[model samples]
Target: MTAQTTDTVLYRGEDYDLIGLIAAEPITPQDFGMTPAMISTACYRGYFCTYAIEDDRLFLVEMTLRERDGRYLPIGGIQPVADAREATCSYKDLRIPVDYTGSLRLASGFVRECYIHMGYQKASAFETVLDFSLDAGRIVRVHDRSAEAARKRGAFKKHFEENVAWGIQESFDLDMDIW
Candidate 1:
């Protein structure tokens, strides 16, 4: 099928089936990190996933969820995003601790996103493991060896990125009282 053909998929808590649009522009490594290899590997390994929302602000999720049987369920939950800017900044302060292990680090280190509802509760947070080499303060490469492993696990599917973006969008569309 051609890229123009839209794909339909089912979602929860809502009757209308959802559709996904493959980004007109495939995410290049430069979009996420300093080098293509890093972005490619990161995208290949579920590291650098980006999605646009209706607002000018950017929302990133570290995990993906689904609505099943009228309840929210986490189909994939890895790192947690903060619920508020304070929480997100606090997370930054704690980045070293989180990145102490290379497991979550990608090429240029991860640009983690934490979703907060202001006075309400925390939505969700996702971290794109950033582990890029730097030379004299310049970005070198994104060296995540999980490419093979991600392929073995089929992490390159386009649905993953779509779902992540949709989840964050849904969170934003909902009323603060509902959450």
Candidate 2:
């Protein structure tokens, strides 16, 4: 098990100072009622977020949406959205908006997930596939997967079957945005 750290974050309609840990566990869509995709593509997809709930309440992460390619893309992690009370505000990484309904309040505790490893783009030919992760919130890892591709490059048919880990995978600070 990884070590746990205490941090604060703005989430949903509340700001919480709480304990967090590395999310080494993977989140799968079958974990939810949905299919294999979270953010789906006519061609690709995104990852899943798993969280721990407190007192039967969980920090719900929402994003600002704009339409693209006939689909809604989460442009920012913040902005106007719903909670126990309706409001639009930037909590943690969420984007702030112009007009929204609701009130922002600081809570006694908060928990949020960060993308420690993300945006692994596969190349078509000889380009290196960069798999990145922020180590200790200081160092960044760009893994060259061209060799891995050379060995196992094939047609990607399934959405959730893609090889990638999304969301916080290890101990990280929340409020300071420390990884």
Candidate 3:
């Protein structure tokens, strides 16, 4: 597993990297009759999504996919297109409302010390963690758990430094065999 690219979320006029899987309405490349090709190791999922929280509602703002020719193309949102291949739309248009009523974990200010090599990082790897509750895509509540995350990170760092011989390395490269 490689370092996967993160999905973006615009919340309260600020963009934050989504920490974990979004438990929203499932929308895939196959739904649009396209098989996206992976263009780089950083994007193992072959696609990435951009979301926005406007007026307390969650919207799927954009979806980008890698073509076989290695060119990244927009597949959904932000445009009036007849099909997925012709997805050239402006940023202001085409906000697909997501019917998601669940909790969302968003993170920012990545902590380099807690870096993991494979897949989406855990919430603890960030300096700030925001837990959001939604009802049918509308944001119902928000909780900032930055201090708790910081405390957990500190404890992990202390344990690692005291036990592991490699003292406080900036990054930890995991063995591919573990995958």
Off by over 4 Å in 1: 1-19, 38-46, 50-179
lDDT, candidate 3, 31-140, per-residue tens: 55556676467775566678898998888777766545443334353332333453322233547787687777778888887765545555666787887788887889
What are the lDDT scores of the predictions, listed in order?
Answer: 0.22, 0.27, 0.62
Q: Per-residue CA lDDT of candidate 1, range 59-157, in tens?
A: 222221111122222212223343342211001111010111111122111113322322111112212112233332233444433333223332222
Model 3 error, position 23 (Å): 3.3
lDDT of 3: 0.62
* Model 3, C-alpha of 162: deviation from truth (Å): 13
Could you list the CA RMSD of all candidates, in the order they appear?
20.4, 17.4, 7.3
The runs of at least 3 residues in candidate 2 whose Cα sits more than 4 Å from the true structure, single-residue gaps closed, are: 1-22, 25-78, 81-128, 155-179
Work out candidate 3's RMSD over C-alphas: 7.3
Q: Is candidate 1 or candidate 2 better by lDDT?
A: 2
Best by TM-score: 3
Candidate 1's displacement at residue 19, Å, is 7.7
TM-scores for all candidates?
0.17, 0.23, 0.67
> Candidates ranked by lDDT, best first?
3, 2, 1
Which 10 successive residues of model 1 have the least lDDT summed? 89-98
Model 2 Cα lDDT, one tens digit per residue, 75-98:
332333323232121123422221
Q: What's the candidate order when arranged by decreasing TM-score? A: 3, 2, 1
Give the Cα error of residue 177 in candidate 2, in Å: 28
Question: What is the clash count of model 3?
Answer: 1
